[model samples]
Target: MEFTDHPTGKRLAALSLAALGVVFGDIGTSPLYALRECFHGEYGIAVTPENVLGVLSLIFWSLMLIVSFKYLTMVLRADHDGEGGVLALTTLVKPRKENMTRGAWFLVILGLFAACLLYGDGMITPAISVLSAVEGLGHITPLFKPYILHITLAILISLFLLQRHGTAKVGTLFGPVILIWMASLALIGLHQVVRTPSVLAAVLPWHGLHFLIANKLHGFVVLGAVFLVATGAEAIYADLGHFGRRPIRLTWFLVALPALLLNYFGQGAHLLSTPQDAFHPFYAIVPRWAIIPMVILATMATIVASQAVITGAFSLTSQAVQLGYLPRLRVTHTSASHKGQIYVAPVNWLLMVCTVGLVLGFRTSSRLAAAYGVAVTASMLVTATLFYIVMRKRWEWKLPVAAGLTALFFTVDFSFFAANMTKITHGAWFPLVIALLVLVVMLTWERGGEILAERARGLTKPLDEFLKGIADDPPKRVPGQAVFLTRSHNTVPVAMIQNLRHNKVLHSEVYFLNIRTEQIPRVPNFEKIELERFGSGIHRIIAHFGYMEEPTVALIFTLCRDKGVNVDMNTASFFLGREKLTIGTPPAMARWRSSLYLFLSRNGMDPAAFFDIPSEQVIEVGARLQI
Candidate 1:
């Protein structure tokens, strides 16, 4: 069930609090390095009073326009059955691919690429966040400088290793800890802001515009670092299903946005007074005594941010697999109460490896910051593009209205993206390369699945024709029920044909089961199964599930029982087709793609295990196919 389904007072408050921990984690932790990067990072500018106000203005308006207006107010409404994300948005716009326009298809591909980009963001967020937080120790004492990298790596590794245990136990602490973190940000930032009230004038858009006009090309480059403040904005929409729109919006407006603004302005205030502290303004505002405690709290907050990103990656993988863009992987549901909490072993480990590599390679958060915003900015651009389609197609907005709003969003997103592009030589290429690789995999997996399905259709006979043949030349009748898994209910399963050919017998009750994934987030139990009886105890049952859900044999049987189709699991023998794919004479795919596809197919989770089917009752019928 969606978190927003029952929006009572207590539930809404709880969800909003939870939203603070998860949805705002990435963006919430930006104070550690965002403003510092603007003045002291790879493309950092001079710390003049005007420049400081300009940068602060840019950061301020970005949060207001991009995060607050575009994402929270606009994109959040584009959810697909209460689910949000690039994949969810893609499905919402194009529920069915039949007769889709070229523009529509491009949006879908763009959305996939966008989702792939998040994987890159997922890797960088943890590394940079933890590194930036740990770097605070160096400010405390020169003694810790040598151990900063080691400490960051240790913390990151420990955090990832704990993924299998699930977040339920520790998740409770996230809300309270983040609440404290946000409170600390506001209090410290306010302390600085009160000392230098002039920093508040950065709220004016003219300071930002004047800085851009005065600095020219250099000012444009500064935008790349300035964009860091808006990095985790996408997570707000992504976690929509988990917390609901109201709670997420409420949290951002009432809690996250205010704290973030106060802290950023405070950093600017500190910078205006003591420009030398530009190296670490976030820590500069803290009292000497509180520096160590703040460091500890910052480390914990960054860890929470990293956890959110890791969880997002797992969720994205599940959605991509169900939506047919990715190969099926083993998904372990972490929280019994929260369906959104899941663990994918492969994703978790791959992320840990990449994240650790980033920390080791970059050596510091300032260097890692150069690579951070590229994927996120690109992803936001994709979201704006997709949101335009959503506004037009789903929301039915007028052409002018849709185009105007999209253009505004596009301008902001593209500016950030273009600025980030300049960092390609520094370190941004890493995430871009990662994104490209993932996009290729997604495209290959999707194309390969289509080819395999086409080949399977050619090999299997039509269901009506096969049933008529069975009626005319009746096979030897056997006791119990036989459940044959098929991709389409309109065709006979190759496994069923192979079984009858070898054993020359049919079970008394035959169930031709087809499990289909829908574009929506979920299908209600009542509408999940469609049962049609052909004749002679032969039935065709189509189990419909949403991309967010897992399809299992046990659940199917239970649903069948509810539909008056008594399915005795103990007596039922499940038949499955195990295809051994080989390269065709005229290669349907490029050689490398074919090889990758083959490897993925070979390594993919077994169907029986994936569907939670009983292994002893599953009878695999082997078939050779070329594609």
Candidate 2:
């Protein structure tokens, strides 16, 4: 499937709207709670005119500098090929030295953690976005307040259940629904802006500066809530693969940004006239007749935002598996034409359980707000750190220029992260804990795999020496071909060796195939396969792929055919080795980690299934691996 990274004409127009539905959905829904959280959440500031304008000013500039300039302009340029995100960034930026230095390893760790925190963002987004939207009922009547939790749980459960179906059929509605949602924000806010024209003064940068000074420490802390408006800014960079820079930038500048600012100013205008509405400023500005309809529209918008984050998680996990940060899991591609549209059942079920637990535990969007910004800000800060290196090491920019730009991004991000850090005791620990858990699992899998591979490589005999031994001894050759999958190209596969030792027979044609996922996103078809004949009936095959791609048995055969090596797929049998891991003294890690890796290895998808080999034609040989 080919994607027009740079689309023009109707393609661009369609994608721009599609970007609104997916890319901007989370940030777009911020109007539901961003302002109200400033004065209504656990940290309630007084709703005085000075404070109102001050918070408004912060929201405006944060969106401009952070979302508009930093992400859309700066970070998007650091994409791996056309892919963006911290994981993708890890592939693009390299160490100056051939060997990864300590500093380079630290940056890699930062990227992995950033990727982990994004999972936190993914989980929290649905809980808060949908809850905030559903909270609109409280304003309608005190009578409906009792049902909010039940109603939210229903919506969330329904959302996760629908994930298996893919969004392709209902995706068309996303653009139109969000279009109305955006238009409503602008139209609704435009009316209030006209009424209290004084609110327009919030756009000036000085009011934000003054508010910080007047409030002192209090104002600084206010950043935690104010940062909520920019919660989904990372999604723009994350979703660059779906809608490229032009459409996302164009939509933000033209549609989503304007509507957000207008609505926010309108909320400020209404609050100035009625400070009592600070508790729910967003819905307060709505006319009585329009409130119910607005809630319906807002609910739809949040659902889409939640769906986008969930799908993004699936994509991220797929990348992690290919990159060896995780054990392979079953990934279901839901869309026939789109490779990116994937569904992972374990991920879906796990997220559903956690997100539902969040609603039950937090009980309200305002409380969940306590947990939102910390993960997101931490992620953004990590991304900025990696982006700095890309500009310096990858792009070859002047040292001072790289340092200056990085510092600038750090200043803004650090402010938010520091502020969010203060809320750790107040529920922000939820995402941090999640991030830590994910980090341990990811690091353990990677480190454990390295040790296992090293040990396996040491045990393997050279292909030439093994072939000569077989040629000299002449093990009885059988009919048809046999393929052995190996982790290392230079070493003989364990399955083949075990087969020879036990069965004492060889196939007429033998293939020692090794598939390695490179740090890059996609290996070109021309450079994918490396085949060498070893003078007997043995062939060595090495296939390379990027983390973003999946390898298939058919592709390997096709590449072999192109390289003048004929393959008889119908007559070939593939052999896979399943490791039964045992814990050795120290075991390359702690006992706990060894057990975890073993569990993952045991439960992981079979290679035959993961690589698209025919199940009937595949045989599994189990070997004990003491780590």
Candidate 3:
């Protein structure tokens, strides 16, 4: 169901609560480490009263300007058919190749790279978030310090292993757990703020301005740590389709923003009085009697955060596959009611191994924090760049207004990005490497599909010519029906031609079906199919689906029936082409990329399985292709 379908007050409230678990988990949990990092991390400064106020001012204004203004107010409005994300935003500006100008192509690449960066961010978020929560055990007692790494690996492994069981059952508890978590943040933080009301002075911009001037380069370097506060701001936009703009905006204003501000200021207040607690400010705010319970709650909150990121990766992979940027992977739907709750095994396991490796390698959240902000800041920069294009081109805003807002966003994004760049040698290079590798794969798959389509067009005859030739020959007509799946709408399918050549007989009814993934999020049922008759019981049916949808044979047939065309499932056969790709002498792509593309092609999910066709009635026609 679309978020717009439910506009009732009760339903909106319910959705906003659910959004808290899924949308705000990452950002909510930032209080666990953000304040601590600014004073005790790799580039941390002294935790005097002035420094406390300065860092708090930076955190407060960052959240207000970047998360509040840029994302919730501006970026959230740029949804593509109710879907907000880099991919959705990319399609809005550059929907089709025919419409793509040089500038559009550059934006598209930036968007794809932004998507790749998320994968890297996805890996680090789980490791660092969970590790930070688990490290609270160290505060409980020094004894747990020796076993923090082992404990973190266990939780991460269990989390990934549990993905196969689906989150339908566990998801019910997410809302309540996170609600309590946010409340705790506010309560504990408010307690400290009451004790040290002087911390409120940081609300003014001058303290942060003075901090930067006094510290100079060191203060600028601290932005890498300050950027952590809003690292999950993108999640607010990414999950826009799930909860809609109204609920997300409402939740942020009423619940998330207030609670976050309270907690951050509370931490600042606590630091002003007890500077030595900078190493563990978040936990220090908790009462001694409540430390164990708080740790448990924090761990749950982090798991919820990690779950959101993992699910996002799966959704992103699905979108990439449908949009033809990646080869098809096995997608298992875990919920009948929610099409978005899907699990991709390859993605799940790969993430687990990498996350566990990160925990093992870094061994502490402080170290992992060094590797975190680089990719996220880069992604935010891309989002800001695309948002600028969206403003000028899609929204058609006046040049001065669009440029002014975008320039402000770019100033913030680039500053954070530049600050994080200094961390490359300190392990920030890991996500960059991962993003580059994934970008190569995506670009290779995209380019390879174009080359293959060009070659296929060269090999196949036009549909009209094929039909005319068949009419003249008058091939023997057989009983029942045949369905041939093809990529091109104008050209004849290789499988249909092969069947006609070998079997020497035509079916009574023939369907040349082509499935197209459109740039939107979801296409309505009435607008899905275009049917045309080619005489002699031959027809061409082009099925249109959106990037967020899965096209199935049964659904297509049902739509066809509505259009006055019927085929008995028991008597129908589905024909598919299985292409064997080989490197041509000249090579259509770089040698390594061609090899990578070939490997991906060979291992991709079978067409029959991908389209939900019955395996017993499927026939594969093999063909060889060079390039």
CA lDDT, every model vs. true structure: 0.91, 0.89, 0.91
Candidate 1 residue-wise lDDT, 118-214, digit = tens? 8899899999999999999998999999999999989999999999989999998888889999999999999999999999999999999999999
lDDT of 1: 0.91
Residue 462, model 2: lDDT of: 78
Instruction: For candidate 2, write residues 171-289 as lDDT tens digits.
Output: 77888888899999999999999999999899899999999999988888889999999998888998887778889889999999999999999999999999998889899889999
In model 2, what is the error at residue 536, expressed in angstroms? 1.9
Off by over 4 Å in 3: none
Each prediction's TM-score versus the true structure = 0.99, 0.97, 0.99
Candidate 2 vs 3: which has more TM-score: 3
TM-score of 1: 0.99
* Candidate 2: regions farther than 4 A off: 1-5, 94-98
* Window of ten residues with lowest summed lDDT in model 2: 90-99
Candidate 1 regions exceeding 4 Å error are none
